[model samples]
Target: MSLATLWALGSVGDRLRVAYRLLSKDLDMQIETTAVIRNVQKGTASGDLTTHGLEFDQLDPAQQMAMKAFVFDRQDDALEWSHGAR
Candidate 1:
């Protein structure tokens, strides 16, 4: 997410709809979901930017399963890597 996304989302505990586009060599899909802003931290990102953690809510069962599968597929990577585009 960008700085604008952070600003538009407001503070922690806020609920927001996020649009996600997943693309790869053979796959493309878009998902829209609501997420709860779980945490925000200053100095956790580059320069003066802040980082936020979101907990997804009201997910379609397939969406949730796909996300879990994606993360599991990359289980060897750093935990933060899977946060992208979701």
Candidate 2:
């Protein structure tokens, strides 16, 4: 998703912990990841995520965008963890 989408979703003030599945177009592989909102600034929202046992920033750009788009689009109705349970 775009920065505009993140803003519309009120990401600046809300802590959104998200999980998403991403399929690599080239590798034909699927990855599941989890991210926790860290901060938002200058029209950009950023967070820490672990995918395939690697930090989000360590992943390729395509993987990063895929995760961001997936989470941003679903944050509104997304479920949250409650006392360690969803």
Candidate 3:
């Protein structure tokens, strides 16, 4: 469950919200609405950027991993697989 996978799955918004809540109170991340959208688009188009916020540098390893997992988990449930076993 990587950030790139989440963005590709169109779940960046959810992950961003979670990360914002987890870090906003302790860090300086503001979770800019427009910036989040722009970052998603950029990540999708260029695939060069790893993160989209000023606070990304401040997050610890655990927080980063948690955010990635959150996004992946949400996306995992949203996907539909017709051939998979129920």
lDDT of model 3 at position 69: 63
lDDT of 3 at 58: 44
- Which regions of candidate 3 are displaced past 4 Å? 1-19, 22-55, 80-86
Give the total clashing residue pairs for model 1. 0
Look at candidate 3 and tell me the lDDT of residue 38.
29
The residue-by-residue lDDT of candidate 3 on 1-86, one tens digit each, is 12433233333443333234423222433232211322443444554545433224345666566566666655554564433445
Mark the 10 consecutive residues where model 3 has the least summed lDDT.
29-38
Model 2 agreement with the true structure over 1-86: per-residue lDDT tens digits:
12223233334334333334443332333444433333444333364322121133244577666666656545532543233344
In candidate 2 the C-alpha lDDT for residue 18 amounts to 36
How many clashing residue pairs are found in candidate 2? 1
Clashes of each: 0, 1, 0
Q: Estimate each model's TM-score.
A: 0.63, 0.28, 0.31
Ranking by lDDT: 1, 3, 2
User: What is each predicted model's overall lDDT from 0 to 1?
Assistant: 0.64, 0.40, 0.41
Specify the poorest-scoring 10-residue window by lDDT in model 2: 48-57
Candidate 1 wrong stretches, greater than 4 Å: 1-8, 23-27, 44-46, 76-86
Which wins on TM-score, candidate 1 or candidate 3?
Answer: 1
